[model samples]
Target chain A: MNKKNNLLQCPNPQTECKECPIRKMALFRDVPEDDLGWMQEFRNSQYLLPAREILFRQGETAHTLYTLFDGWLIIFKILDNGKRQILRFLLPGDFFGFQVNSIGPTGGYLHSSLALMDSTLCAFPTTQLRLMMEKQPQLAIRLAEMEMHDMNLCQHHLIGTGRKNAQERIAFLLLELFHRVRLQKQNDYDESSNSIIFPLTQEDIGDAVGLTSAHVNRTLREMEKKGWTQCQGKYLTIRNEEALSKTGQFDPRIIISKPLI
Target chain B: MNKKNNLLQCPNPQTECKECPIRKMALFRDVPEDDLGWMQEFRNSQYLLPAREILFRQGETAHTLYTLFDGWLIIFKILDNGKRQILRFLLPGDFFGFQVNSIGPTGGYLHSSLALMDSTLCAFPTTQLRLMMEKQPQLAIRLAEMEMHDMNLCQHHLIGTGRKNAQERIAFLLLELFHRVRLQKQNDYDESSNSIIFPLTQEDIGDAVGLTSAHVNRTLREMEKKGWTQCQGKYLTIRNEEALSKTGQFDPRIIISKPLI
Candidate 1:
C-alpha cells in the first residue's frame, strides 16, 4: 500500500469472517458461527486508507458501509462558513458510513469520514443492508443497539459543548477517547503505562469540542501545568485520572454498554 | 384527566392500533393492516401528561417506551452544575424513551423527558421490543431507519452548537422545528399560514442551542426587527423563510427522508 496516497485497494485476499479478529465486536457479532460464510459472501472488499486521507466526503453518493478493522477516523461536517464540526471519532471495531440524507440508491453521505491514521476497513454494499437484516433479524437489533450507543455519545458531546466550559470539554473528550481505546483491547494500549497513542491534533480537538485551536492549546497547557494530563510526542498520559474525571464530570461507565444481541 | 399533576392516568379506552390518527407516521407505520391487532395487544396503555409536566426523569428505571400520539416534548440532560442541554425536541408521532446507558432490564433513562404541552402517549413494555422485532423484522428495519434519522438531527445540532453563531443556531433550530411541524400534516399547521403553534419558551431555545435565555431573546428580537421572523403570543411566524434558511444553512430536504419500511 502507498503511504502517500489517500486510499489503496489491498490486493490480499479478503479476510474470512470467521477468522476476523474484530468480528466479536462488530455488526455481525450476533450472527451464529454457522452463518459466517453467508456474511463473508456479503462483504465487498477490504481497503486501506492512508493517514489524513478522506475515506468519503459529504454529499457524495454513498454506495457502501464500512467496519473499521484498524486505526482511527473522524466523521465530520464542514459548514457553509468553512468551519468544521467533528461529529464522531471512530476507533477500530466501529461501524460507520451509514449517515445519509436519504436511504434511496442515490442518497448522499451527510458527513465526511477521514482516517486519522492509516486504517483498514471491511466494506459491505449498501444495497444488501435491508435484505441482510431481513435474513438475520438479529443484525437489525444490533444496528439499533449500536445507533443508540452512538446517540448516547453524541448527546454526551452535546452536553459538553452546550453546557460545559473549555476546560471541562477538553477533559471530557480526552477521557472519552481514552476509555474508548482501552475498550477496544488493542495492542496500542499498554496496561503497564498510563498513556495511549494519541493521534488527534489541537485543531482536531477544537473541532470536536467546539473551541478554537488556541483555546484548546491554552486549556491543554493549564491541564498539563496541574499535572492532570500530558499530551506530547503523540502520546497522552493520564497522570491524575481522578482529577481529570472530576473536572470533566465524565464517568467511564457510560461507555461500557453491553451488546443487546 | 387532571391538569394540576404531572401525570394523569386516563380512563378513556386505549386507542386501537388501526384507528390511531397518527399511526401512519409512527413506529408501527409500516405494520400490515392484518398485524395491527397483534400490535394493539402489545401496547400497554395510554397516559396524559399535562403541559409543563415531567414525563420521565434521568436515572429513573425505565420499564416503558412511548410513542407520542399528540403534543410536544423535550428530551434533555442536566449537568451537575445545574445547567441543562436540550438534546431533542419531540413532536407528534415521535417515539422515544429508549435512551438508556444499558439495555438490561434494570437499565435507567440517561435523559429526562418533559411535555411542553398537553400530551398523550401510547406505551409499550420495553421487554417486548426484542421479541416483537424477531417476529416482525420490518419493525426492526423501521426502527433502524428512525434511529438514523434521529442521529442525523443530533449531528445537525452538534454542528449548530460547535460551529454556528447564535443567530445561525437560533435560525437553524426554528427552521428545523417549523419544517418538522409542517411535515406532520396535522391540524395545528395551516397551509395558508406561515406560523405554527410555537410552544417553546426563550429558555427552552437557549438550552437547545447552547446559549443563554438573554442571548436567545436578543437574537430573536434582532431577527424580528429585521423582518425575518416573529415570536409573539405563543406563535412563531417566518416572515422571510429564504433569508432564515440562508443564515441557518437549513435545508428542508434533510427532514424529508423516505421511510425505509
Candidate 2:
C-alpha cells in the first residue's frame, strides 16, 4: 500500500488458484484440487511491481508472505556501512517474505526486495499462515521444501563471496541465473538458444557477488575475451558452457531439479 | 556408519524423550506431551562425535537428520580451490544435516559437519520426515519456523562476508556466538560470569568470517588491547558488551528470542 514503492494492486485481476499457470511449481503444488478454494480465499491480492521498483523495504513490518507469480526479484540487505548484499534471486513460483524476526517485538522484514523487472506477486496474510497450514498440512511440507531450496542457494552465495575470486563469482552468478531462467520455462528463454534476458546491472551483479562494479566489468570482459561467455544489451549468452562451468565450479545438476512444491 | 567419521553409536542409552533437558528448544518443542512417545519411537538412535571429528562428509548420501543434544559443531563447505567456508555454528538443541541435493541423482550432503568438541546427537531417518510431519502437523509448522530461523542466520552471514570489513565481521561472529551461548543457558555460561567455554581456533574464525588466521589473530589482539574482549585458554569473555555490540552493529534482541519450537 506504499504508493512510492510503485506497487499496483490487483493488476489484471486475481488469477484463480486452481487455474494458476505455474501451480505445479508454486506453493500449493501439493494441495489437493478440492482444497484450493480455501487458498483462493486466503490470498490477499495480487500486485504488479514495476521494473527496478521496491517491493518491500528492510525493517518494514512484514504483514504478508508472497509467491512470485511472474518476473524476477532480488532480496537484499543494506548494511550499516551502506553497502548492499543481494541475498537471493527469486524466480516465478518462488515463495518469500518469511524472512522476519517472528519472535521479536518489531517483527520486521530482515531484508528488502526489489523487482528486477516488471513482476507480479500473489500475497497471503501472514497471520493466517498457521491456520492455513493446519487445514492443509501439505502446504507446510511444501514450505519447508521451498525453504530448503532457498537455503541451499544462500549457502552457495556465501561460498562465492567468502572464497571464490571475482571471475569465478561472476561466472557462477551468470550461469546460475541462466540455468534458473531456462529451467523455469520462462518466456525469455528459447529452447534452441543459450541466451536469456538478463536484467541485472553491473552494480547489481557486484552487490550480489561482493565485488566492485569496476571489478565486475573487468572480470566480465576477461570472461568474454576468453570466448566463454558474453553479456551485451541485457542479454547473456553462454558461448562455451563447459569452460564457463569449469571456471565457476558450477554443477547444473545441483540447480536443475523438480519443483519441491 | 562411516568408521573414519568417528561416530559413536548409542551414547548413554538414549535419554528419555519425555525428560529431554533441551526439549523446549528442540524439534519437538511444540509437540504435546502425549505425542512425545511417538517421537521417541521415531528417533533412530543417538550418536557421539568426538572432539574435532567429522560427523558427516560432503557428497555422502544423506540418510539421517540430526539434533545436537550437547557441545559445539560447525557446518562447512570446502571449495574446489580447497578454501573452506564455515556456514553455521551449531549449539546444543540446534537441528542440522538437511543441507543436501535432495532431487539430484546423488542425493548427497551439500556440506560437511564437524564436532568442535565431544557432542551428542539424536538422529531421525530423512525418508520418514514427511511421514512424521503428516502424523504430527505441529511438527511441520515447527520445521518451517526452524528453517526460517536458520535462513535468517544464513542471510546474516552472507551479509557479513559480502559487505562487512574484517573487524566488523569478526565482531559480529563473536557477539553472535556469545549471545547464543549465554541465552541458551548452557552449563558453560555461568549466570554470574561473562565468559563461556569457547572452542573455535583462529583458523576456524578465519574460515567463518572470510579472513585469514593471521588477520583474525590481529583483530582479536586489538580487541583485547582495547579491553573489549578476551579469549584465553578455552574461554571467551566479553569485557565491554556495549562497545563490542556497537562495533559489530549487533542487536542482541535479533538473536535472543524464544525458541520457535
lDDT, model 2, position A172? 89
> Candidate 1 DockQ score?
0.57
- lDDT (CA) for every model shown? 0.84, 0.82
Give residue B137's error in model 2 in angstroms. 1.1
lDDT of 2 by residue, A96-129 (tens): 7764422233577667889999999998887877
Candidate 1 chain A: worst-modelled 10 consecutive residues by lDDT: A97-106
TM-score of each: 0.95, 0.94
Question: Mind giving the per-residue lDDT tens digits that candidate 1 earns over B1-261?
Answer: 222336677677767889888887788988898998988888888889989888877777777888998899999888899999999998878888775422323477778888899999888888787788888988888887888778778888989999999999999999999999988875645687888889999999999999999999999999999999998778999999999999999988878656442
TM-score of the B chain in each candidate versus the native B chain: 0.93, 0.93
TM-score of 1: 0.95
Against the true structure, candidate 1 has what lDDT?
0.84
Residue A37 of model 2, lDDT score: 94
| Candidate 2: residue pairs that collide | none
